[model samples]
Target: MTPSHRSDLLTDALLHYSKKVERKQITLLPQRLAKAAKVKEEARAEFTALLQSVPGTTITAVRGWGEDLVNSLEKTSISLSWEEAYVENLHQLELGRTQLEAPRGGAQVLEVVKRTERARRQVDILERRHRVRQRWSLTTTDSERYLTAAMEKRAQAVLDSVSNLAFERKFMCGLMAKYAEGQTIAKKLSRQIHKLNSKIRRNVKLYNLKRPVIPSSSTLPTLMTFEIAMNPESGLWSQHSVSHDAAFQLKQRLFVLLSLHDRASEEMNIIKRPVCRVRED
Candidate 1:
């Protein structure tokens, strides 16, 4: 046969087989989508857990700060010029404006306002510190360094998980390619066996004088010459070759599945965070 003829025949056969494979893929699509969704959900849950496990939150307590500011303005009140108020309003505004450090202004409102100001100095303190004030309200922005370091480490872990998911997606593409190639190889092998058997049936008399001619469908690789000569071989050679090709293709399918399995196994390697250690390993 001409190369073009062979190519056309293979293309037709591949179209048929590929349609069968594609049908199977269609059925499996929902399964793949479900599994991928599960993986993503699990990763998100772990990310949430990591966020919660951190000592302080990224979200600051700013609403309390606003309320405190309002209270301070109301107490040591400063009113608008359009206001028609009594002397009490002026006294209230003067009281509100007094510095928190003043000798007479060590009241509850002033103390809370100072603590609120200190807490506002760093959001991390606002998150981690439950106490508002004490004998004194003191804060150091130096505490900012530790908060940044801890947050950076957790962010890196989250990014690592994202990378693992990307790698898993790429690895799955390899599986798809491997199965595609295996299908092509199997189809070609089936046709090759079929042609070889047909040739032997037509030309057996040319290859052997003593041997009786065998039929095209009976001369498979596994059949014995005596079986063919005695007419004991059934005309199932093509079917048997198809079965062998299918089985070989099954092994390649399993190999592709195993590759995807490895990606799932390695997923944990990306999400784990190291605990504090006194010594480096």
Candidate 2:
């Protein structure tokens, strides 16, 4: 949808929900503390809800994504240690406009407000730092799941197949090279050996399969292998959430299989073939 269309829909939804639109471009969120990142967001929402439950209190999240907070605030403000920033934002509240609005016994009430705000900002600083790759503490939770022994077995099966195929390719290629080398050595010995060298070359050309690079996610293997001209399709070769690096690792096993076959053939030549074997037909 166009941005204008999306804006209209959002405006309608907010209005339908009895939400007031804020005039300020910059918004500050009340601070939150929670264990997981998901829980952090939930805690921030809960904090805001708790504030809103009071008749006169208001709490809000910062405008836009987490980066928006970093962008709206001055660099020096963010650069301060979390404790320092909390203390500073609180100081601003106590000494700034909020303090002037305070009635009798406002200083005591203001202190409470300041403490909450300061605590909240500490959480925000940690969240903001994590949002940017400024530091990389966050991680994906894909691997942590309920035991799926059956799925694991299937994955192993596919992996084994892929491994065998990969080994076969590499082994065959090496074997072809060896045979070509032997043919070259043999052709130097006799004119009759020239045909054997030619035969090996033909076999090498026919047997060496160049597997096309298809995306792990591509439904049709041939689609990604073909390059597009201008404005190449992006995400075409991107990894499918389903298909993974395991498949690629499996694909490499073909090489070893080919190598084993060549080894067997070499042994047959060394032990099975007799030196006196000559035929006149």
**Best candidate per TM-score, number?**
1
Model 2 TM-score, all chains together: 0.17
Write model 1 residue lDDT over 92-209, tens digit each, in one string.
Answer: 2333446444555347766656654543444334333544243121123322333333333333332223222222333344435534556876556555545544443433333242
Q: What local distance difference test score does each model get?
A: 0.38, 0.35
Candidate 2 displacement at residue 5 in angstroms: 99
- The 10-residue segment of model 2 with minimum total lDDT is 25-34
Question: Which prediction has the highest lDDT against the true structure?
Answer: 1
lDDT of 2 at 115: 62
> Which tens-of-lDDT digit does each residue in 215-276 have in candidate 2?
23323223212122011122422322233243432222222233334454454454322221
lDDT score, residue 18, model 1? 78
lDDT of 2 at 175: 42
Each prediction's TM-score versus the true structure: 0.21, 0.17
